[model samples]
Target: MFKIGELAELAGVSKRTIDYYTQLGLLEPVRSETNYRYYPEESIERLRLIDALKKQHLTLEEIKERLQIIQNQPDAADEIVDKIEHLQEEMKHIQEELLELKPLLKQLNEQQIKLMTKPLAQQGYTLLHTLAILLGGDPFIN
Candidate 1:
């Protein structure tokens, strides 16, 4: 356990910022017998995440919501790992397919290459939608 000053220093944040997060129910610290606030080691990571999200331009409320989801989902880490592994496999397959396509691409004329690329560029939006679905929908899309 660490006192607020120590935690703030370790997390590279100000004590006032930690206090504000505590007030907002973002950080929960334990009260010592002497009534001093003491944060656990995990608080350092939480503070870092809060700072990173703030840097990403998320509102405090949005950050709180995202953190709440993370806290509530006990199996999220496992799920994320599985998803990452699956994506890696998919990427490997795509890389192999790209290698196979390389010879065909070399034979294509400029006009043929342009036509092929235009459709592939349009498919990028479809890829984005697929990614959004895989990622539990777009939270930042308004």
Candidate 2:
């Protein structure tokens, strides 16, 4: 269990955000004997999901509805876990590819770099796309 402040820090959100979510019924925290609210470790992942949905332009109500539907699905948790694992594996592969390209990247001049990346950029797969994919975000959103 974590205090509200701790959870906020861990989830990269503000304490007020968590409080607001709690008020909105988006987050549920347990009350201690001291009347302090404490969140479970899973809250971090929940906040991250909420943040991701917001980035996808989902309204709070829409996000809540989606989350409720996901919760009601028996296999949703397992599917999400599988997807996260797959993404981690892909990130590892990307890291290895970047390592392999390090020497070549260093040797490339500005024009050569632009030439190498231009095709990918034209295909909407620029550095931002790579970052979005790595961060489990929808690359095509922007």
Candidate 3:
């Protein structure tokens, strides 16, 4: 959970923007008994999606409607949110593993690096495509 300021900083937006988004029903923050609003980490991904849409020339009203449609889908929004959390965890683990392997990877020759990545290239492209889709980009892009 993140406070408004924390979420604003993390999401690369202003607190005013968050407030405006909350008002527009784009961001849903939980209010505690003390009246403090706490945003989930998933909000960051949502903010990313909103930014992506805005960049594509979507107005707040259109984005809100689109989000409503997405939320109305039975289990689809929930499943995607759950998947995003799981994917974030997986990405953290992969980042840690990559850091641990950095030294060994650095020692590999060009040919050896190519040999190792050959099998992973397809999987890497698939992951990229999936992420692109999640961020509302064209999946067909290389």
Which is the leading candidate under lDDT? 3
Whichever of 1 and 2 has more lDDT, that candidate is: 1
User: What order do candidates take by TM-score, descending?
Assistant: 1, 2, 3
- In terms of TM-score, the best-performing candidate is 1
Off by over 4 Å in 3: 1-18, 27-66, 139-142
Q: Give the TM-score of candidate 2.
A: 0.55
lDDT of all predictions, in order shown?
0.79, 0.77, 0.81
Model 2 C-alpha lDDT per residue in residues 1-142, reported as the tens digit of each score:
9999999989888999999999987888999999999998777877866776676567888778766776687367556645655765776897798688778978999999998967756764565677677545675876
Q: Say what the RMSD of model 3 is.
A: 7.6
Residues 64-134 of candidate 3: C-alpha lDDT, one tens digit per residue: 87678776773566565566567667888988987887789789998998898777788888888876785
| Clashes by residue pair, model 3 | none
> Clash totals for all models, in order?
0, 0, 0
TM-score of 1: 0.58
In terms of lDDT, the poorest run of 10 residues in model 1 is: 74-83
Error of 1 at 4 (Å): 0.8
**Model 2 bad stretches (over 4 Å):** 81-142
